[model samples]
Target: MSVRPPGECTAPDRRCILVIATVASFLTPFMSSSINIALPVIGAEFATDAVLLGWIQTAYLLASAICLVPFGRLADIHGMKKIFLTGITIFTLSTLLCGLSPTVNALIALRMVQGVGTAMIAVTAVAVLTAVFPAGERGRVLGINVAAVYTGLSMGPFLGGVLTQHLGWRSIFLVTVPLGLIAVALTLRARGEWSTPRDERFDLIGSVVYGTTLLALMYGLTLLPEATGFGLIAVGVVGIFLFLWQESHTESPVLQVRLFFENHVFTFSNIAALINYSATFAVSFLLSLYLQYNRGLDPQAAGLILLAQPVVQALISPAAGRLSDRVEPRIVSSVGMTLSAAGLALLTVLTEETPVPYILISLVVLGTGYALFSSPNTNAIMSSVEKRYYGVASATLATSRQVGMMLSMGIVMMIFSVVIGRVAITPAEHAPLLSSINLAFMLFAALCVVGIFFSLARGRVREDPHRA
Candidate 1:
């Protein structure tokens, strides 16, 4: 689909796209973050160890990471509306299956399917919004869409905890079914499908190689500090070289590997995104454990305490998005990264005796920093790439975010293996847990420091004329 000039689109059509994007955006994060609060409950019910329990989250993300790029390409070749609706249907059905799952293994399998659907929705949503909105309004629309993500995150904990506490963890999935249906309804109410006109063949080999590469890399990250894990990491690194070679030689690549080497703005922006998510994604996971297990708070209290970060993100993201339209996104994004580093550095010192107020303040700082960073950074990335690459570009950025999240979880899991062994988290293990959390934060903080440089190094972004 060619980019629609801003004014050429009917106002109703713009609203329809934005509304569908916003609603669809909310479902994934809400489900993910809310599920984070319920992890302890799920783990206990399943009688599974932490490593296995981690798969509940990892499997979905892994599946999404593997499929997003290919699905994005598919959307461009087929139609975004068809892919988006199919994803919504599959995700809703899988969510119901998840709620009914009698076993952890079953749930994990369902989640993997859910992840495939998520990949479809995630990539297509960005492609559609960028396609319909004009350049001048791009940042603002992207910001609003991003804010919906944060809003979902913010609501997930408190609402999820309430449902988990009252109706059991299963209710969380049930509740989302309605929301998913609503999104589907809104999307159906919208008029037409958006997709680039194309006849290019799908690169099946490249897709397989790309998927396998991510699966190996993410799995390796989870097994870190183990000798075998190091071997796996080596294998994954080799896979990367192979994937790149294939992409270069393929007639039509699923991912334009050349962009990473050739497009300075795109490369640095994606790297910056990876760093930012790697540094930040694990915050709530660590904190939920810290609050509930170490600090002796219940799930409800823990959820409330964890709510501060995304709440700030929810509040500030749209404004930051609007700001990026007028100023350089890198300037805004670099400052945000610096602030995130500061917030994370402060968090590294957290102990059992740390005051609640201090923790909340740290969360606020981190949240504020993230809020400023995410939307602007996203705007920079989407704005940097050409219109033809929109689906791939969107998928690439989303993939970086998911991959970084997997890495974040891997870092935490590795620390858990080293610090606490395979035991279930106990009060006796709180000190080691603190050590793990602190270690994760320190690593994350350092990553943010590096991220700020990448944020700056992205060349001055040329405004996308497709939008203009």
Candidate 2:
């Protein structure tokens, strides 16, 4: 086993570093979904179509995926602190620009820049935390970090709705400015050190090629429902091939395709993550509309109701992580995914007149399942790689997550568009919209079922085993 050098600080100091890193990680998801509640208002203001509206979220996901690998490598080359601070600065500035954007085009452009900043922070966070914490404590520290992420995701809708209703949608972006400054201050105060600079070089060509490929594929996916022309298919197929070729030949490939082949644990964890996230993305995105349009819930009520999932997730994640440290991650992850799929299946019976209690129960079940699944699953992924390669490993996992989310959004939108197109009426008409959302939920459940299979396939590894 290859044991990397521990962090410079003592255990207590390392704990502090974990706290700081967790806080920084929170910014990404908080910003990502907080904007969802505001999309309607923004869409109306900009006269954006459904297809163009999708870009608001897609731009962020695409940019983040494109930048994660390169930023991770940069963290290894220079220092995590330098790259992290730069990212925070950029994120804060771009958020301000987003708040002030006068047009849809400008807002989309600024969001892409914001996503770059988010990617930098996100890609570095897990590596930094792993470096600070000892192997034995890694699972707990990561669990807390995961909890923070879910907390942010849970709070996003409520915050967004409240702010948009009272303070205007722009306030959502404005609020992050101070939080960003606070995070920067804390990071500076934290104590941790990296090794001396090595003779490493960034793979600029690989980064560009990978970025272009992901952009093309994501764009094609986004456009597929509206424009099912041959051009979209051609772009997706060609882009995917080029991406594969680039990764195969590059000396320092961005994605580390070899790792996927050699490590069964890594492969299954990524597959499970992708499937789980796709289901999550579909449910959250569609449910927001379902609550508001079909059930006559206001944005604030809808947000509050959605909070059920994250609240339970926060409650159960630590326990799940601790359990994984004792048992096989495959068992924990498989059971969790199964529970989540069941919860989503329950949602298939939802109707416009469904009781609020039933909806909350379903959400709680989903949240519990997610909490159980996420921490253990992430622990498996992070533990599989050598400590020195934590940066790349974490980046790959994060990229998988973003890709899943982006794909889920695209697929859900496509399905919704098709379902709605068959009806000669607007989405504001309750019955047709409810039917569409029901179908979407059923599709999401099916994806979760696939996650269960992948989770089961993740062969057992010694929990927190020494890395090579």
Candidate 3:
């Protein structure tokens, strides 16, 4: 069997790795953004309630976060290439199943399957990329990978809106099938594996603890201001403390809790990521609703207006990534948080009469801030770890992002329940919906403002491999 030698790293294998990783990176966000635009359509067809509609997004993110760290550890033990390929196969098949789903529950279930697949891919993708490229070039490639994510986001709404408007929402899932197949095929061509020890015991107890705790916490958040919600949340918090204690003692923990305590950069970067995502993931979802419900625009036109942010993100992420390699990631990421906070604060003033240009400008500001924050923050986390810890570190960062996404959605769910109740959105419901959106933006802005300090508190990255 022909294999690319480990020593041969300048171009051939590196380029191939980037292409495959970029494709995988693009696939999930495209599905997510496109699906967010289609949520109203899906609700209309199924006659679903608001709470269940929110679950369309929440279930996937919750599952992905719960499984990410475990899958990352498995990849570290078995082989990244194998795990990554398996994830692609599962994702492609699940996407097919999603297209064929006949009910809302069925679609949500298959999305959970897809979420498991996503966790696998997300955990290994960066680890594989990091393994292929040296540190000097790592930030550049990672930025490009991040750019592909934004590119998917950039196109998802427009493509999803068009497809949903014309061919139906099922087509959104169907279209991804071809792209996913190509990713699987490309991954198949790659040779070799990335795993260490080859015999580390899988931490089943830790996995159970982590997954249950997250599920409780996120699900509880969705039910906020309720008695059971508070109960569940309190239990979940205690569960987290217990999980940390268990991990500190485990011989082969699913996640190394100690890393967060030991590495300030890794810890704070992840904290910033969590806050940034919590403050941002729902922007597209909320805006889609606002444009369609309040502005009386079609999905296609609304998608075009919503395109401003991610387009900027796609264009600028690589440059920001490259910039991190030269300067301290903290400075760039902190500034990004500041910009993000400003943009979100602007969004708090949104009203039914808010102009098209104003919305576009806000998206641009938010996207630019995201571009600056994401790549550099990611660089800080990945670079701060040992080579053997790359898989876990990558998974941890992905976890932070996914958890934040879940929290973002949870906040939306709680607000909708309290403000609008569990009803389908209509013209008459516009005022309450607008109120909810405004309040959400205000809360997010405040959260991101706090993220600025965390981003800065990370201090300088420790570059010494020995320290890692």
Candidate 4:
């Protein structure tokens, strides 16, 4: 468990690794974004309720959140390339099965499996990128990685709409198969492998406790306003305390508990990430429904409209990343958080009669803010850690993201459960749905406003001696 560099690699090896990681990065977000567009269609085809439709997304995120930390530790101990390749193979095959799923239940099950693959890819890609690149180049490289993610998001809505309209929702999953295969094939050809040379045993007991606790917490959130939900949440809170105690005593903890307490930059930066994602991840989910159900737009039209935010995100992320290389990342990210809050505030007034241009303008603002925040924030977190912690660090950051996403959706599902009930999105249900969306926006905007402080409080990453 002593500190050291994970491994070394040549320039060519760096290039190959980046390509594989970027491709893998692009894969998950594309499916996630596209699937949002396909949700209405999927719901109709299955004759399911709104809460059930929300579960389609929740199941995948829950599974990912549960596994991310464990897989990340495995990557650090075993080998990044081995885990990365396996993840791609699992994701691609599971995606195909998801497309062929016979029922809603089957689709949700497969999505959980797909999420396990996502957990493997999510934790390792950044760790691999960090392993190959030096400190000076970290921001630029990570920016490109973030850009690839936004690019997948950019294509998802437009292409997902087209596929759903023409071929059905299944086509959205089927089309990603080729790209996943390409990443796998290229990974096989890459010769470099990286891992921390540690003899520490994997913390199986800690992993189990962590996963089960997170599951209870997330599931409880979705079932809010109910007695069972409150009871489960209380159990989750107690489990968290137990998990922390277990980690502190264990020789090889799955999560490094001290990182949150001892490391100033890592702790606040991760909290900022958690808050930022919690505030922003549901914008598209709410907007897609707003455009289609309330405004009566077709999936294609709604998608084209919803495409604005991620398109701006994809466009600006690299530049923002490069900017972070020069400026203080906290400063850059804090401003972005402010802008995101402003955008969310604007959306709080959305209605059936709200002008299309106003909604588009709000999306543009959110996109700009997100682009500004994401890469710099990522650079800060990655730069704060030593090379040996890269895999766990990456996993920790990804865990924040996945957990935030679950929280964002959990807010929506809870609101839906209370306001709109378990009904389908028929015209009679439109008023309640609109109210739910606006209320969610109000809560999210407040969360973003609170996150700005954490972003600024992370202090300076460049000052950290371990940055190299």
- Candidate 4: list runs displaced more than 4 Å: 1-18, 132-144, 189-197, 386-390, 460-468
**Which residue runs does candidate 2 get wrong by more than 4 Å?**
1-20, 132-144, 185-195, 225-230, 421-432, 463-468
User: Whole-model lDDT for model 4 versus the true structure?
Assistant: 0.88
Q: What tens-digit string does per-residue lDDT give for candidate 3 at 163-253?
A: 9888998999999999899989888776555433267899999999999999888788777778988988998999999899999999999
Count backbone clashes in candidate 3.
Answer: 0
Cα lDDT of candidate 1 equals: 0.85
**The best candidate in terms of lDDT:** 4
| CA lDDT, candidate 4, residue 356 | 96
lDDT of 2 by residue, 1-468 (tens): 322344557766676677667877787788876787777667667766554566788788778878887787777777776788788888888988899999988998999999899988887777777766678888688768877788788789898888877888799999988888877777777655532333576778777777776766666664555565336657767876777677788776666777777788888899999998888775766677677667767667777887788788888888998899898888898888988889989999888888989999999999889888988998888788787666667778888888888777766656645665433233555676678678877888899998888898777766424344
Give candidate 1 misplaced runs (Cα > 4 Å). Answer: 1-19, 130-144, 185-192, 462-468
| lDDT of each candidate versus the true structure | 0.85, 0.77, 0.87, 0.88
lDDT of 4 by residue, 1-468 (tens): 433344466678778878988999999999999899888889889987788888888889889889988988787677777788899999999999999999998999999999999999988887778777888888688878877887899988999988998899999999899988999898888775655545669999989999989888877877888999888889899989999999999988999887877789999999999999999998888898888889988888888988999999878887887899999999999999999999999999998999999999999999999999998998899899887776567778888999999888888888889898877788888899899999999999999999999999888899976575
| Clashing residue pairs in candidate 1 (N, C-alpha, C atoms within 3 angstroms) | 1-195, 1-196, 135-467
- Candidate 3 residues lying further than 4 Å off, grouped into runs, are 1-19, 132-144, 188-190, 194-197, 386-388, 462-468
* Per-model C-alpha RMSD: 3.4, 4.1, 2.8, 3.2
Reference-based TM-score of each model: 0.90, 0.87, 0.92, 0.92
